[model samples]
Target: MQIYEGKTAFRGIAEGKIKVYRKDQQQIKREHAENTQEELLRFERAKGEALRQLTGLYEKALKEVGEANAAIFEVHQMMLEDPDYVESITNMIRTQKVNAAYAVASTGDNFSQMFSMMEDDYMRERAADIRDISERLVGILAGRTGSQMELTEPVILVADDLAPSETVQLDKDKVLAFVTVHGSSNSHTAILARTMNIPALFRVNIPLDDTVDGKEGIVDGYHGRIYLEPEPRVREELEARQAEERRKQELLWQLKGKENVTLDGRRIEIYANIGSFGDVAAVLQNDAGGIGLFRSEFLYLESEDYPSEEEQFQVYKKVAESMAGRKVIIRTLDIGADKQVGYFQMEPEENPALGYRAIRICLDRPEIFKTQLRAIYRASAYGTVSIMYPMIISVEEVDRIAEIVGEVQEELKQQQIPFGDVEQGIMIETPAAALISDLLAKKVDFFSIGTNDLVQYTLASDRQNPKLEQICDPHHPAILRLIRLIADNAHREGIWVGICGELGADLTLTETFLNMGIDELSVSPGLVLSVRKKVRETKLGEKYN
Candidate 1:
């Protein structure tokens, strides 16, 4: 057996034939076009076709991966329609009198290379996106039928690396597992594996060439190993392991429709975090009790301009209605940090996360904040809706939000607009907010501790930087202490507290959080069932009391 070692992306076991997945590379030849106008027309038609294809893929991804991960397509659509990108391709066709395919291919190469050479890591990643869109245009120009790998049978698919666009187009059932020659654990492949519950291994320096195709392979995600043409004894052991995994999955399914209560009879709320109205389907499928964190920023991030009050109203209304009376805690626009939109036209900052973000922006720009508040208030008429503000530092910010919300309610009353009772809450993310939670808790009905940012702010680390990924500890004692502190303070004020961040989904600390009197956990839809299983298995009273 040829053994390969890699980092575990997802924990599972699978054995199947190997399939070396190579994306279709369309060769473009430079040719002089007799009519530049006709070539331009051809490029435009292909661009339109590419956009259409992206939309279909996006819809498919929404149902499969939810709106957050599926948003790459929307970004791709914007990149495809970028004026600068279009101008470069058209300029080549007009000036050089080249064929549309050649012009697109050449321009795409230049742009992709330019991005690849950029100093920023995030910008370097954009190089792959640029290439993905460019290749689509060229393929469309060449009359290619599809840009997906066709798998007739289940196999362990190996690749050099996968872009988010390519990974979404893959058929989950047909692929037994994913083994990549190069990719970080946070890569889209890993995220997709977790979401789909598939075995995956990354950074395995395996032969990605066609010669390895059709060889029998085994993926042991639990052990972080890949066995090619395994020995009979090893294969048998792995087969036994696979059977146990299936039995475990069947047990997890049985936990569905069961209460998310601990063995100690402690019943706490379990909710799903979503990014768009499209994610409501996933929320229901996973059987979450409520929508704890409905990120309203996607409406702004995905738009060409500021989303209108009416536009935001429709989205919020659909989500509230879809929840069917379940509590929907919608967080107001948490933009300007990591998620930068060009339309805002804000000046660059040394540390964008600490400067001009979340509640800070909303308080400064009352008109923008009021527009979203009105939409949420209007949607409240459809179902139970609560508002949460992020990046809050003090009680004054909560008071300011209450002031604006009061004006919004008054305006709606004067205009005879129908609205409903909406609870106001602020996120306890900053150290300042956590430190004074007792005072801030009095101003709001609930507190959702955003651990992702809380940890970042408390430790003074950039959460987005890959280099600090290991050093920035989510399980740091300081963060745990802060969570307990916030929960304690909120409890004293007779207000509920919830954790709506990455740490909430951690199974290792499930009992610790339960003992701390955490009221709720808001995690991704894929994790709801697993966390429920953890909660049901824990005996908090017996262990701690």
Candidate 2:
């Protein structure tokens, strides 16, 4: 038997014949359809065809995977007809004068890539589904049908990787398990395996070749290992370990309603970050203490034009009410950098991350800033609401924000509009912001460290550039020291501090953050429980003091 280590996406065991997954030619050529009207009509036909196909798949899935899983196809159908998604594809075709296939492909890539990088596991899973539907539409337009796996018997599925679109096309009953060379725990294929109660692994370093296809394979998800043609003795040992892992999984349910307190009696709030009203359900499902980073940029990113104050207010209010008295800190526009909206008409910059963005844009255009502030203030009456400004480095920016906020409140008062108290805070995401955090902390009610950008700026490495992934180290003592600096400054001013970046979800650093006097840690919704578990396990007594 040949053993290979992998990351566990789901915990289970399956021993069966191996089936390798291969897919269709997915290269989409960029071409102009020349006529926008003609291309749009073509896209409509393809979308219609996609909807029909999903309906057929839905019925099939119902028989094979039950209603809960079948609902994915139904949701795919709705997504195919979703106005926003359709508009995105149509707008690209019209503006760029692109072919229907190219439009669908480009728009899908943009949307899917955005969701894939999100911190939330559910949101990440959604990335694959978006790609799946997008590719289906592209395939129809391109007149291409990819490789289809037709299994007559149950097998342990092996692949270099399986796309989200590919998994739904499989016969679930014929798939005993999934083992991929690449994918995350939240990838669509992994989700499918998880739902089916089968073993699944991702990022296995082993080579995937035809030599192993059709051979007996063993997937031991508990210990993150897969065996090709395993010996009988190995199978027997794994079965015993598998049963123990299943028992431990049952204990996972007990984590709910448990306090996020350290072994030494120190407590910290665990919050979830979200982008839209639709994400509130996941936030609550994960049992986050509150919504720490409600990215307000989606209000801009998803809109054709700047969202109206009432439009922004309605969204914020709905989320606030949904939280039902839990803390809701809405971050102001964090556009530019990696997130760009076409309507902004921003002049291209060599380095947008360090250029006119976030607070800079807001300060330059107070009218836009005031509108958002007014909406946030108006929403404050619905629940416990707080407003946070992003990309602030100077005391002057905070002063300007205060001035604008005052103007907004005054306008509301003149109109006799009722709004509740809203706490003000700023993001400490730059070296300059970190250096002067003590001064900045006194001006805001709280401080949220945006470690993703902070690490990039500190290390002079672009966080978005994959080439710098190895070079940009978030664990450098420099980053830890910075967090401690920001946390200390916030505490010195008697204001709470929290991390609302990628590092907040890093379980290894939970104890370090707690010791730094971080009052809260905001992470992706699906990771809330894991971080909470870590927090409860940390023991810091005199060291914290």
Candidate 3:
């Protein structure tokens, strides 16, 4: 009977049998030369079936299904075309002459072996993805499930872990909510659940075998709690809370069409921090001002090939056109250890966040940096494009970045490329970035404080690590002071400062940022209306002291 509280992202209380998926699937038998031809036959059949199932997901009827429910479909598509995966399996089958199942098994074990040696947790976790996809292929070859799990009644998926592919195969209309023993906030499965607006919780770290077998219990995704055999009083309280949540959500929807003007006639802008075109549509639907954080991570994810200048330009152009006249602040290719671009070879590090990430990577690879800058500058002609650099620790970084940007601009001009004037900026994530605001202010056009990482680094806590997660507070006094310094410095220099982080959505900090001279707040699409409502309620000259 333990209770935990967190911001309610989704409202629902469901009770169901916990179907756990704990098997890594990577520890399987390898194929030998005697059965190689048979394994190749099996591999081709599985590959073809994988393609067919993927095709079915796109067949208009299935296309409209929830993204969380359609993830396996996408993963299967990747398996069908992934040369690295397919070739490895094919080469093993041809060279070793092993049985079909043994060949797939061998390939899975090889991938798992390789991934386990890698340092990145995310990449290591991807080994599970490989196993999951390979097992699905094996299942398809055996006529077992074919990515379809017969979830008859509403059930909470209780698992030690759930992969993005497994979560995608969930029956969305029937799924009440999901509870997992292990997963982070940024895990693809958790992200997909959020995207589908499903009530899902992770990092439970509890055995669901006895607690959730057949007994009636409440799985509260909002609070990340499980009430096993709850009393009537608890049920009543939950029902009341659910009702209140519904009312609040209705109010948020009603505020969407309304203006976000502050008391005393001041107008404040509310924008959405989006990562892709799909996100742009969501922002537009929510009536956001424009895109604030058009993270270029999606481009890196979509292709193994380094997105050429023209390829990058077209993507940026599409986002710009979608925004129409609204400002689209495009953050230049923010890449590093955390977000590894497969094509680039990077040295492994003990600490990825403090390691070669963002501007640090760009500085080392000037040609790569120049290519992205050139693409951004070229895209500026199509719409309002602002070039932003991530993780700037000193003014020297900004100066070097600006120098590279100028070089790119001159090169583009020499080639007679039509590009517009793009504003340059830096993300105030590090304490150093915020502390030296005056120096950076002189070198950049503006600042967008990424408070998520800022709070983590400022507090000396790893936000992703469960052990130190409790100390990663955005509300800490030091973080607030740094944010204030950044905002004040930008304002004094006649440049605007905006926050593109979870802090922007925090009602308690909204007025604090405004009082500190912050110009704008960029949050998720679902939060825009509520934050806008809060902004309208704020008064001028409200002292934080």
The Cα local distance difference test for each model comes to 0.88, 0.83, 0.74
The predicted structure with the larger lDDT, 1 or 2, is 1
What would you estimate as the lDDT of candidate 2? 0.83
* Regions of candidate 2 where Cα sits further than 4 Å from its true position: 2-19, 25-138, 141-226, 231-249, 464-467
Tens digit of per-residue lDDT, candidate 2, span 1-545: 89989889887788889887666668888886768999999999998888888888767655654443455676677668777889999999998898889889988999899988975445566777788899789888888654367788999888877765467677777787888887776454675566566678988876666878878888988789889888989988887776776675566557889999988798899999887776687788878999999999877865657899999999999999999999999999988865666678899777777898998999998889888989999999999999899998899989988988988889999999999999998999999999999999889899999999999999998765545778899998888998998898888899999999989999887887888889999997867888888888899844332
Off by over 4 Å in 3: 1-33, 44-120, 152-155, 204-217, 228-232, 264-266, 411-417, 540-545
Residue-level lDDT of model 1, residues 1-545, one tens digit each, is: 89999988888998999999887768789999999999999999999999999999888988887766777888899999988999999999999999999998888899989987965555666787888899888888888877578789999999988777778887788888989887767555577677778888998989877557889999999999999999999999999999987897788778779899988798989999988887788789888999999999988887879999999999999999999999999999999866877788789887677798888888998999999999999999999999999988877877888889999999999999999888888888899998998899889899999999988889987676677888689988899898989898999999999999989999998899999989999998878989999998888753222
Order candidates by TM-score, high to low: 1, 3, 2
Clashing pairs in 3: 33-96, 33-97, 35-97, 35-98, 36-97, 36-98, 39-100
- Candidates 2 and 3 compared by TM-score, better number: 3
Count clashes in each candidate, considering only residues at least 3 apart in sequence or on different chains.
0, 0, 7
The TM-score that candidate 2 achieves is: 0.72
TM-scores across all candidates?
0.91, 0.72, 0.84
lDDT of 2 at 354: 87
Tell me how candidate 3 scores on lDDT.
Answer: 0.74
